[model samples]
Target: MPYTAEISRVNPSCFLFLIDQSGSMSDLFPEVGCSKAQGLADAVNRLLQTLATRCAKGEEVRDYFDVGVIGYGQNIGPVLQGPLAGRDLVSISEIAFNPAKLETKIRKVPDGAGGLVEQNFQLPIWLDPVHNGGTPMCEALRRAKSLLEGWVVAHPTSYPPTVIHITDGESTDGDPSIDFQKKILAG
Candidate 1:
């Protein structure tokens, strides 16, 4: 049986976010009152920040995790935006330092007087809303396969990277079927 491994500075885990920025993602989500793209970007930025905080040691943040965010749409590949452009599998500290921009959002909060109070929260965004042609799930998975393959080769003893794949259920190029996975993994 395979035992669970402890996540420490010397032997840490990884997280790769696969976000779908296809045309369908431009639709406003009634539940969230925002586009899917916005929600996804917010979630990813929060995750990256949280990981960095968890790995902080004293004044400096330790590189205890490898993080990556890949957004696929018009062209399929890793997200080429903000400080993460042209980069893949960056350290936790890098993720902490490379937000595209931080915007303040005014939200209503419960006040002691039983009324609502306005609160400003900082929102970090690494990718913007991009509605383009094609879903291209196959190409995206292929890219992910390549990245994971390279990561596994480099960190053979570390825990396997966790991939959080979010899609809009559209595939224009081809289906990302089991055969696709087999083909990618086989090669």
Candidate 2:
């Protein structure tokens, strides 16, 4: 099946996270007792960490992926922090090299005897929580499509880029479906 493409350092895949950072995101998420922005930020950061870890071998981190965190709100653009602050797309190795911050967190896990044990883990973050202006999802999608088109051109033989778009299911801008469909057919 075409879905069975081999994933390796030489022929890696890509991940693009399109996060919603609109003012509405500040609204509390009843399930988690936190804002939507917090949830989105946490998800993006964790995904980046996981991807880097997946490419880790011994003490070396390989370039098995290219990742992006695109936040759309007051401004629509790449939202990575630290050394990768302004970059739109970066290799997995680059993300491993540049972390906005490292946070020590306590996690509980089950022991072999079914008892809980506490462990500390150093978590890395590339994007922070931001809840500002209106949701410009249309513009963000347009930008992502353009970026993906370029990526496909560059890595035509590699596994197709995977875009994980996290939004609040609302579009302050007009319906993006019109442009979205036109581009889909034209492409």
Candidate 3:
């Protein structure tokens, strides 16, 4: 029962995790119980692990669905952003070291089966708690569009690409959602 065995015959899919690294993300979100950045990073890491299993089972990590993550906010870094291939995602050590400013804190707990469980914490890397001002959400969207374009060009017939943009506040970059959606649909 390899991870990719089940989806080998299915079309490849790409996932673009567009994260909002805006200053407002510093606040605690109920789902994560921590800053938005920490929660997002943990989520992304879990997703990568899930996808990795599938990839190892023969699912084409890159050809099927190229994965890329773009972060925005005070200092959005594509630290965990890359292809779905094992080589692209951030290594565990990397996550422990320099997590993106927007990510929450995380720890690996024993899985009780000689493995470990990653526990999410409430710490953030780069969030600014500003009441008002600029939030570079549009910038992130634009970057996402660019990355998606390249991926779609290669796998045009593959499953529709998934671009997930996580933002906690309004866009300071103006109304880019509609246009961004259009680009995603057109692609």
Candidate 4:
């Protein structure tokens, strides 16, 4: 007699978080609490925590999911990292607190191990709706596409990639979204 055993089919998945740090996002969004930048950080941290927990449980997070965070705003450009790529995966809270800019002067804290630690994390330059000028969402999307393409090519056996593009305004670079979409889809 033949018997079948239960198996988890949660294959690996990749998620691209394309955030628009353009000036427009600075606009107040009631749901996000605080400014959009803060809201973005909150949401990202929450998502990362959830994934980390699931992964820890031998669930779909680590066994079958890779998270890529991309932030575009201010003059900081973008920050990219692959969470779950290693054991010492960076926490979402760390990412949330660590922005491209230094809010206050760097502080030094005693490590308690006979060493001193100099903290370098700074508050991110919140994307303002007026001061920053136009939104370079297109460029951010292109970067995401490149990253996704590379990830897909490298992990051919991985599950399909899901990209979550969050924006507060339309593209200032005409209609590059369609072209960008085509390029990504063709990859």
Cα RMSD (angstroms) for every candidate in the order listed: 2.2, 1.8, 8.3, 10.9
- How well does candidate 2 score on lDDT at residue 175? 84
TM for every model, in the order presented, reads 0.87, 0.91, 0.58, 0.59
Instruction: Please give the CA lDDT of all the candidate structures.
Output: 0.79, 0.88, 0.57, 0.56
- Model 1 TM-score (2 dp): 0.87
Candidate 4 local lDDT, 135-185, one digit each (tens): 666777777667777866866666667788777778776577587678769
- Regions of model 4 farther than 4 Å from truth: 1-11, 30-33, 58-63, 75-77, 80-133, 181-187
lDDT per residue, candidate 1, 12-32, as tens digits?
678888888888888888987
- The candidates, ranked best first by lDDT, are 2, 1, 3, 4
Q: Which candidate is the best by lDDT?
A: 2
lDDT of 2 by residue, 65-179 (tens): 8888899999999999999988889999899878989988789998779799999998898888999999888999999989988988988778888999899967788688987
Show the colliding residue pairs in model 1.
none
TM value for model 4: 0.59
Q: Which residue runs of candidate 2 sit more than 4 Å off their true CA positions?
A: 1-4, 111-114
Rank the models by TM-score, top first.
2, 1, 4, 3
The residue-by-residue lDDT of candidate 3 on 1-187, one tens digit each, is: 3233222224566677777666676678786577665676656666654655455434333333455666676644464522212222232223333334434557899998999989996543322222223577777777766666776686555666677777777887677868668866997
* Candidate 2 Cα deviation (angstroms), residue 140: 0.4
Best by TM-score: 2
After superposition, which runs of candidate 1 have C-alpha atoms over 4 Å from their true positions? 1-3, 184-187
